[model samples]
Target: MATANTAPNPAQDTLALVGRILIAYLFIPAGIGKLMGFGGTVGYITSAGLPMPEVAAAIAIIVELGLGIALLLGFKTRWTAIVMAIFTVATALFFHKYWSAPEAMKMMQQINFNKNIAIAGGLLALAAFGPGRFSIDKR
Candidate 1:
C-alpha cells in the first residue's frame, strides 16, 4: 500500500509567513497611530458623528494594537484576522465612504476606502490559510 505524504510543503509555509508579516505590517502603523494620538484619529472619529467617539476610538485602538500583535505572533491567528477584517470593513464604510464628502475630498476618501478593502482581503486570506509551521499555531 502506498503511503500518502504528510510532510509540510515549503511553498505553503512561505505564503503563510508572508501573509502574516504583510498583514501585521499594515496594521501596526494604524495601531500605533491610535496609541500615539497621531493624525487626530480620535478627533477624526468624533468629527464623523459617531455617538460615542471616545469609546469607538478606544475600541479601534485596542483591536488594532491587540489583535495586530496577536496576529504577528501567530496566536489565534484566524480569529484575530476575522476581527480585523470586520473592523476594516466597518472603518471603510463609516469613515472612508466618499459619497457624502465634498467634491474636492472625494478622491482621497475613495482611496482610503479602497486601501481598507484591500487590507480586509489580505486578513481574510490569513483567516483561511492560517500561519503555518513558522507560526505559534504550528502543530
Candidate 2:
C-alpha cells in the first residue's frame, strides 16, 4: 500500500507567497485610496457615527498600509496577520453593520460585512500557519 506523503511541499511555499500578495491586495490600495482622499474617508467615518473620525482614519491608514506592507513582505507574519484580522473584524462591525443600514443601503452593507468576515478567516489562517518558507520570518 502506498502511503500519502505528509511532508511539506515546496509548492505550498510558493502558494503562500502568492497568498500573502493576494491578502495584501485587500489593504494596500485601500490605504492608498483612503490617503488620497483623506477628507472623503473622514467624512464616511463621520457618517458612521464613530467617535473621533479623524483619529480612526489615521489608525485605519496605519493598519491597512503599514501592516499590509508587512504582510506582503512576510515580515512579522503571524503578528501582522493577527493585527489585520482584528482590524478587519472591527471594520465590519463599525462600518458594515448591515442590520443598522438603511433599506436602500442594506444590500451593499451586507456584502461588505460578509466580505470582511471572509478576509478575517484568511488572516486567521495566516496567523496560525505563519507565512511559509518564502517569508521573511522563514517559517
Highest lDDT scorer: 2
- lDDT, candidate 1, 1-139, per-residue tens: 1125564488777778888888888787788889898348768987888877878988898788889888888989999999999999999999997988899999999999999999999899889767777888885
User: Taking the tens digit of each residue's C-alpha lDDT, what string does model 2 give over 1-139?
Assistant: 1125564478777877899999999899999988999999999999989999999999999999999999999999999999999999999999898998899999999999999999999999889877878888985
State the TM-score for model 2. Answer: 0.91
Assess candidate 2 and give its lDDT. 0.90
- What is each predicted model's overall lDDT from 0 to 1? 0.85, 0.90
Reference-based lDDT, residue 25, model 2: 93
Please state the error at residue 59 of candidate 2 in Å.
Answer: 0.7
Best prediction by TM-score: 2
